[model samples]
Target: MAQRIRVGIVFGGASSEHDVSCMTAGGVSRAIDAQRFEVIGIGITPSGRWVQVAADELRDLRKQGGTLPRLSESRPTAVLLPGQAGGARVATIEGDRLTDVHDFDVAFALLHGPFGEDGTVQGLFEMLGLRYVGSGVAASANGMDKDLMKRHLAASGLPGCRFVTVTARQWSQQREQSLARIAGLGFPVFVKPARGGSSVGITKVDRVDDLEPAVLLAQKFDPKLVIEEGVANAREVEFAVLGGRGGPPRVSLPGEIVMRQAGAFYDFEAKYVSDDDAALLVPTQMDEELRQRSADVAARTFEAMGAEGLARVDLFVTADGRVLVNEINTMPGFTHISMFPSLWAVSGVGYTELISDLIDQALERPVGLR
Candidate 1:
């Protein structure tokens, strides 16, 4: 029998999206192929401690009653050390004695948001010469910052929504000027933390009066804030891209998000808490030409950012048929209900197969510069 690959599933990060990462990890722990891969759950506590999480503990963390689960620091502290044969080993430290856990053949990072998704952990993997899923350091960092991401997208000659960014220092020094720049983007704009995700610090301001407060709210998450002009009468659509080891990436069918409740965008609650807030339309009922165009743009966006393993590119399809790229999530949400997996599921790739494909791709990829 072939050796079962030891795959370390890292989750429960030190980001505002910690709970979400735990949720993603729970889904992955349940979905990964048990016959081919030996799964190890590494949970990072909110205070930034790495600990070992049991498989059943992860499985029991299912989303219930709209409450998200988080990793606690009470678990045994886990450490990753360089192995003798150009690899890494995970061990658990209990009291003063240390027990060797498992050496990872590859890592499947289920972390999201800063510290995890923003290339920090990727850099650690690279330093340890351990191959991990998702984009490399540069790509992860670039994809996490909305401002830098939009700049890269526009430089690549892609069509993206008009946006303006304001730093905390700039806002403090010249509040009026900052507001003026944002005003140019017009009303009904979205104020978001430039380096945040899961719609945690996103606020949609329909009028100029509420813009500053929204910006403040976003700044609470990060020092930099991005204000983007809302696409008029636009429908939110997403396309998933998966690849890394060989030819061009594969683009999944576009999915549409229908906001069910009035005055509710795809906010945090709408995305994970309240299922009735929105419904997904897979392979959206869009014109064939438009759907293909969106798919092509999403693939191009993924390549432009130098993303690997997988990514989800969001787009805004206006009523007039204009498809504008909204943003690209390098390490997007990966829960079963998340749009990334849902899009691929509809595109014929089951959840388990999708996880397997990502691990295979990561194993095939080299750790250093490509």
Candidate 2:
């Protein structure tokens, strides 16, 4: 019998999206192929402690009652140590004693938001010479920052929503000038943390009176902000992109996020808290030409961002038929119900096969300086 590959499923993080990450880990754990891969659950606590989690424990990660799941610090503390010959190992730490050291082959990082998704963890993996799923350090960093992502897309000649960036220093030093630049985007702008995800720190401002308060709220999540002009009469659609094996990246059929409530954006609450506010439609109806155009743009966005393994490209389809790029999620939500998996499912890839394919992709890639 062939040896089962030991896969490190890294989840949880010191980000606002930590709970979401935990949920994603649970979903992946449930769907991943058990016969071919040995699952090693590695979770990071909200306070930034790495701990080893059992497969059963990861399976139980879910929202109970109204509370989202969090990693318990009580689990044995864990760490990833550099291995000989460009590989990695995982071991548990008890006080000052290290034990249960095991060879860890590939890392399926299910972490979302800052510490994990913004290239910090990727950089660590690079230094350790370990191959992992998702984009490399530079691509992960660019995808995490909305301001940089938009700028990158623009430089690649892609269409995006009109927006302005405001850093903490700039906002404080040139308050009036910054506000003036934002005002140029007109009212009804989306104030968002430049590097935050899962809609944790986003606010839709209808007028100038609400703009500053929205900016302040977003600043709590990230010091830099990207306030974009809201697309009028636009439908929120998303596409899932997966790296091809020795070929171009693959783009899935589009999915649509339909907000059931009037004037309610797809906020954090709508995403995780309430289930009735938003409906996910896979293989959403679209003109053949528009669909092709959207897919082309999404694939281009993934390639231009230098993303690898997998990514989710979000786009806004205006009623007038203009398709504008919203942003690319290098590490998108992987829950069974998440749009990324749903899009692929409709595109003929089941959840389990999708998970297996991603692991295979990671294993096929070279570790260093790729």
Candidate 3:
């Protein structure tokens, strides 16, 4: 029999989305083939400590609010040595300094937000000469920041939202100047951390007066900020693109997010906490013309960003019926109800099959300056 591949499931990151990352890791670990791959859970606490955790324990961590998962309890811990070229390695620390070397074929970085989802972790994988899931370093970095993403999309002729970058230094040094620059873009704008994810520090400032404090709130999360020209009552649509053009990439049926009674927008509460704060219309209610156009935009955004494997392209349908790329999630949510995997599931790809397909892509694709 062939040796089962060892998978290092890296989770828990030093970002606001740390808890969400744990949830994502648990969902992915549960779906990964047990007979095909030996799963090892690596938890990185908010303080950056890399501890090995048992699979069941990882799931239990998610149910901190008096909920429970369907698994027995066991705690596992491991240590990660820092270096990319020698490849990622782990040591099982048990008892009084007793250790054993445990290597994995590839790592499943189920990390979200700044430290993990951004180019940081992917850069390490590049140096280590290892295969991992999601986009490469450049793509990961671009997708993490809304400002750079818009630039790449515009340069590639892919439609995107109008926006400007506000550095923390500039905001602090000349608050008036920064506010003037943002005012030029118009009011009722979106103030977001340039390197944030999961909409943790996103605020919609309708009045010019509210803009400064909004930017300040965003600055708390990241050193950089982005204020985008708000798309007025634009329908929030999403389309999933998988694989690359070398082989035919599949576009999942579009889904629409209809905010019913949530925060002013889809904030952290609406996205992660609220059970049914918004209505998600899958295979969205769109005319064939708009549907096809939305799907095309998804592919274009993915291509323009130079993405590989998979990406969830979010768009805003204008009042006049044009689709504009909001941003791309190179490594989107895979938790049970998350859009990334859920869209594929309804589009004929099961959870287990989706996990297998992603691993297949990582294994088949070569790791280098490609």
lDDT of each: 0.87, 0.90, 0.79
Q: After superposition, how far is residue 161 of candidate 3 from its true place, in Å?
A: 2.0
> How far off is model 1, as Cα RMSD?
1.9
Q: Which candidate number would show the highest lDDT if scored against the true structure?
A: 2
Count residue pairs with overlapping backbones in model 3. 7
**Which tens-of-lDDT digit does each residue in 265-306 have in candidate 2?**
889888877979899889899999999999999999999999
Candidate 3 has what TM-score?
0.89
* Regions of model 3 farther than 4 Å from truth: 55-78, 81-88, 93-98, 261-263
Q: Could you tell me how far off, in angstroms, the CA of residue 49 lies in candidate 3 after the best superposition? A: 1.1
**Model 1 agreement with the true structure over 6-117: per-residue lDDT tens digits:** 8888998777778888988888888988899888878899999888886788777777897889887777788987753435788899788778577778888888878888
Could you tell me the lDDT of residue 286 within candidate 3?
A: 88
Model 2 segments beyond 4 Å from truth? 62-68, 84-86
Order of models, best TM-score first? 2, 1, 3
lDDT of 3: 0.79
Kindly indicate the candidate among 2 and 3 with the higher lDDT. Answer: 2
